[model samples]
Target: MEYMNIINQIIILFLIIIVGFIAGKNKIISQEANVTLSKILLNITLPFLIISAFNFDFSKNMLKTAVTILIISIFVHGTLSIVSLILYKKQEEGVRKVLRFITIFSNCGFIGYPVAGSIYGSEGIFYAAIYNVGFNIFVWTIGILIFQSGNVKGKGLLRKVFINPGIISVSIGMTLFVFSIKLPYVISETIKLIGNITIPLSMIIVGVSLCGTSLKSAFKEGVYYYASFFRLVLVPLVVYFILTLFKFKGIYLGIPLIVSAMPAAANTVTFAQIYNGDVSCATKITIVSTIFSAITLPLMVLLLK
Candidate 1:
């Protein structure tokens, strides 16, 4: 029964994605305006969602869980980094770089928060935020180097890692969580209301992004399936088994598993564009992996039961 609820939630989220697809096809969400919507989601709604997730009363166990999850998040990324590097080393330079980036990062924020919130409520979002702290840290640092070929340097690199929306929002949320500081009722409710916009808005953005790509071309490359298998299946399965072996269970095991199983980060396309990588290849892989995840993610959730 519980697993069925999870499946239902995933189906609903995907239905929203279909709406965005139709909207994109109908020109209801123009490509230019989709970019603006992405900005609003990243800079505004996402941060509020992070902050609002921290509104619960502080507890020692929760704090310990947060710290533990943060460590696991970093460890998972570090190991995946090494694994991805070796896995794709023989591919052409342009395709290799994008493959590594997509393999190492997942769409943990946009899809992660909403799914976590649905499953574990505020506590799920809280831990998802903690897990994402490691994502922001590595993504801006090592992730940038992958595409830039280590050209980015100095204080500029540090600023990008530390000053981005993800890190900043996590810092604010952590501060509130640690101090047990409560916003006034009005402010708290307002933040929650704004944060609620994140789920459908993000899924719609994904749908619109997908609508712009050619389904035939996106799936034509056999390499896209190979990479998606790693990103959506092998990585998460490895993480789940290893963590369960160590006695992690319930949300501790579940949240990380869900995040690991997410599609390639949407930022894969954005970074490929910014870095002059193979933008077409990146888009194809991202779209293909995301489409596959609609099947994989629900299966991942059912494993929790």
Candidate 2:
């Protein structure tokens, strides 16, 4: 029954994505509108979710767990960076940059929070938020550096890493947790309601992005397949087993695995656009990996659990 429930959760998420795909195909939502939705998600909804997640009472063990998970997450990204370097050593500069970025980062925030909440509720999201601290920090710093190939000359580097919504929420959330601060019940509840919009909105954005892409050409790149396999399957399984070997149990083990298993982040295209990388290649990998994740994620959970 637990296994069935997990599969159902994955199916429900895919169905939501399908809605966005249909909307995109029928011109129900234009690209400009979708961009607006994405901004709302990152700037507003996700931060609320992060704040609400910190409603848990503090404990020494919880702090320890948070730290451990943070370390593991950094290690996971660092190791993937090495793996990507080795695997794509001979590729062209643009392909190498995109491949390295996509392989190193996962869609931990947008997709991860909802799936973790469905399976493990608030506790799941709490850990997801912690894992995301590492993700947000690394992606902004190291990931951006890779994407731009160290083009940090004139960009507001500090603002990009420290002042972004994700890091801001993390900062606020951690402060609340450490101080045992509580918001008014009404305020917390309202934030909770707003945060709930994130899941469907994120999937819809992904689905809409998939609408006009040449799926065949996306798959035509043999390297895309190799990268997808590495992103969707190989790395997550290795991380899961490694965590298990260390005796990390329950949601601790599961949350990281799910986050690790998310397809290439949809932000790949955004980064490509910003850094003048291969936008088409980034889109193909992002869409194809996400489509494949609907199958791979549930299987990872079922087997790992």
RMSD, one per candidate, in order: 1.0, 1.6
lDDT, candidate 2, 1-305, per-residue tens: 28788788878988999999999999999888899999999999999988888888888888898888889888898888777767787788888889899899998877888888878878788889889878877788778888877778645876787788988887888888988998898988999899888889988988888886888888788888888999989989999989999998777788889999998876888998998888888888887888888888898888655
After superposing candidate 1 on the true structure, give the runs of residues whose Cα lies further than 4 Å from its correct spot: none
In terms of lDDT, which candidate is strongest?
A: 1
Model 1: per-residue lDDT, tens digit, 1-305? 38888888889998998999999999999988899999999999999989999887888999999999999999999998888778777789999999999999999987888888888888899999999999998898878888998898769889988898888988988888889999899999999999889999999999999988898999888899999999999999999999999999987899899999999998998999998888998889989999999999998887899
Displacement of residue 238 (Cα, Å) in model 2 is 1.2
| Candidate 2 error regions (>4 Å) | none
lDDT, candidate 1, at 273: 92
Enumerate residue pairs that collide in model 2. none
Query: Cα RMSD (Å) between model 2 and the true structure?
Result: 1.6
Q: What C-alpha lDDT does candidate 2 achieve relative to the native structure?
A: 0.85
Q: How close is candidate 2 to the true structure, as a TM-score?
A: 0.95
Error of 1 at 61 (Å): 0.5
The models' CA-based lDDT, in order, is: 0.91, 0.85
Per-candidate total of colliding backbone pairs:
0, 0
